[model samples]
Target: MTFFLPFSTVARLRFGSASRIHIFALYRWNY
Candidate 1:
């Protein structure tokens, strides 16, 4: 399980950044 920790963290960071960019695009579209 120890080896899986870093993979999960990296996936979470990537997903977080993707969602942030998506939200930013939507906000720009609305305004």
Candidate 2:
């Protein structure tokens, strides 16, 4: 479990950033 924990966290962070960027772009067009 210890070995897989860090990898999961990093993957979550990367995915979160990508999603955040997409959301930002989507919101930009709302104006």
What candidate 2 gets wrong by more than 4 Å, as runs, is: none
- Clash count for each candidate, listed in order shown: 0, 0
Model 2: how far residue 17 lies from native, Å = 1.0
**Candidate 1 clashes between residue pairs 3 or more apart in a chain or in different chains:** none
What is the per-residue lDDT of model 2 for residues 1-31, given as tens digits with 9 covering 90 to 100? 9989999999999999999999999999896
Q: Candidate 1, TM-score vs. the true structure?
A: 0.75
What tens digits encode model 1's per-residue C-alpha lDDT throughout 5-30?
99999999999999999999999999
lDDT of 2 at 2: 100
Under the 3 Å rule for N, CA and C atoms, how many clashes does model 2 have?
0
Clashes of 1: 0
My TM-score estimates for the predictions, one after another, are 0.75, 0.64
Weakest 10 consecutive residues of candidate 1 by summed lDDT: 1-10
